[model samples]
Target: MILGRDEANKALRAQHGQRGTQARRAAAASVIGTTIEWYDFFLYNTAAALIFPAVFFPESSSYAGAMQSFATYAVGFAARPVGAAIFGYWGDRIGRKTTLIITLLLMGIASGVIGVLPGTDSIGIVAPIMLVVLRLIQGIAVGGEWSGSVLLAMEWGDQRKRGLLASFAQMGVPMGLVLGTGGMTLLSALLPAESFTSWGWRIPFLASLVLVAVGLVIRLRILETPMFAAVVAERRTSSKPVTDAVKHHWREILLSAGLRFSEQMPFYLFTSFVLVYAVEERDLSKTFVLNAVLVAAAIELATIPLFSRLSDSIGRKRVYLSGAILVGALAFPYFAVLKDGSALAIFLIVIASMIPHAMQYGPQAALIGESFPTHLRYGGAGLGYQLASVFAGGPAPLLATWLLHSTGTPFSISAYIVFSAVVTVVCVIVLPDRSRADITDDNVYARTPGKHRTSS
Candidate 1:
């Protein structure tokens, strides 16, 4: 069924138009799915900061117990890479949609379980252990969730708008953070402290089950991404996707892990650990910190998409690099603002901090997804992202706590975030800008036949 060149061109254009529509749809799904996953994740983090120590690990000293609870919080991050490997393989081999759905369900069940689980007073030694177990499941589920959702959005989008679309997916983080914190804040305010501690926390976790169901329904309506479908139809699925990702894309993986180090570390520091730091170190009320976070997260929700769209006109690297540099410079100032303990100062600092965070976070998904090929894209991105959980996301809160306790100076924490930004700056300089690269065809596997090495 040969056609004229003009006819072929026309057909290609039509296909591209359809792909554009699909990309938009996929991006919407990615945003929704990621929001649900992070809502559950952030709710736990908020609880850990405000309530978990007393509720889950009741026997230790107040400070020791909080540290212990945070340690358990880190356990999920430790298990992330393992989950990434397991689900990432399935995402690449079977389908991104299927793997995403499975991850969402896993996270929903874990969150729901946490909502209903008996506390240490009721279950004694078994309660914290169960909490840790559920956290591990969450780590695994969410480890795979981000890569799948981002890849779906990136694969469907045009090269020019990839950053914008990808950022939309990433925007889910701030959105989820806002929702999670807002829900807790509302509950905390409405219920008396006694009732809030006793039962209000459970409402947010239970609410996740309903959100997950909504996410599942929206996701089920969308078709598998055209790019992944093409891979399946051509029988190009990697039999050893994880190994191939490691052997071929190891450098990208390392760079990505390092690139993520700055963002995730500072993020948890600012959002999760800051609540405890403010209350314990600065003597500010919990409500003040929560309100500050809510303001920051709200600003981020609006700024993330704006920056992502801006990256489409400018380049991804330029936007991301600027963010890295900005955060590096502002790390010290941000903590200094918190030191003042005034509500206005806290609000201003939060807004300022979130701006740079949003700038980097917005384009991050497309940038990372563009680093690998379609066949191993899921495994490659998932492994790179999840591996960072150990050094970056998982250890952030613990390290911040340790730094504060050890140094008694908040600047010590600033130095840690600055170091992460430094690592990211170097990684960004080394990696090529793939904004205009033809990701659909020109990739590591397409260029190298038997041996798989991704060309820069």
Candidate 2:
């Protein structure tokens, strides 16, 4: 049957509306999935700083116990690269939606188990060992989560607006920090100190089951990204995405990880190490330091997307380098203000500190993910991004704790932050800005420098 012109126009408009709705839903799913995953992940960081040292290592000295707790925390980061390799393969082979679902379930299950696991006083040496194992699982799950979530969000929409769309997934980090830290603060405040140490910390972990459920519902509703669909249709999917990425895109993989040093290293310093500094070194209340972190994270939620949108107009490198440079600039002052400032002054400093990190983190998703073609993006981006956990973030707190004790000043730690910033600056300069590149190009083996395209 032949349709009228008006009917054809109406159907076209309806189809466009449906596509927009699908894009929005995919983006929302990315944000919620990452938020839930990071919520469970960062909650362990909070526990390591406040509860695990005492609960799982009861026989050790205060400093030693803290060190052990942080070691286990680092173990989670160490597991992320493995998760990246495993999930990145499935993401390329099967699809983004399915891979993401498995990661969410893995994370939620690990967290819930940690909540019920017996502590050292009850289970002896096995407690800390088991904690390490569970933390490892959490790390691997999140390792896969970042690139998949960002790709899910970015691929569903216009590739030109990738900076903003990717930032939707990036927002999950700060939002997770806020939710995890804020929940801990409120519970610790309400419960008796002993009770909080005993059981309050477990509440968030157990609640992750519910949050993960919500995330699954959102994620399951979305279809695979259009770009991935094309990859499958063209028979471009790889059985060994990571192996190929390392063999072919090794330079980008290394540069991507180097680019993360300033962002990830100093981020751990500002959030996790700084918490240790406030409570252990400066004798600040856990609640006070936590509140400061919660506030900083809340502020980041607004600023992260703003900077990401700004990158769409300017460029990724300028916004990113500015943030890297500031990481060095603020390294020392961040400690000084926390040590000597009045309540209002310290609050301001804590809140002011993370804007630079946000500047990098917001644009980072698109900048890194843009480095490779659609088919290889999952493996290449995931490996490069998660590798930073091994060298930068995973050891930050442990190193900071040692520096504080041995050097008797925060300056040593400040110098370390500056060094990382310098390394990142070099990487940002070397890595091509693919902000304007055609990442949707399905040519996985293109020889052209930054952007990929099929030869006519």
Q: Give the Å shift of residue 54 in candidate 2.
A: 0.5
lDDT of 2 by residue, 1-456 (tens): 111234334333433566688788889999999999999988999989999988999888998988998999999999999999988877776778889999999999999999999999898899888899999899989999999999988988877788999999998999889999888999999999999999989999899999999999999887777777766655556666677778778888899999999999888877887777788766888899899889999999999999999999899999999999998899889778877877677778888889999999999999999987777788889999999999999999999888888998888888999999999999999998989877876443354234322211
Q: Write the per-residue lDDT of candidate 1 for residues 122-146, one digit (tens) a residue.
A: 9898999999999999999998898
- Which sections of candidate 2 miss by over 4 Å? 1-17, 442-456
* Candidate 1 Cα errors over 4 Å, as ranges: 1-21, 443-456
lDDT of 2: 0.86
TM-score of 1: 0.93
- The candidate scoring highest on lDDT is 2
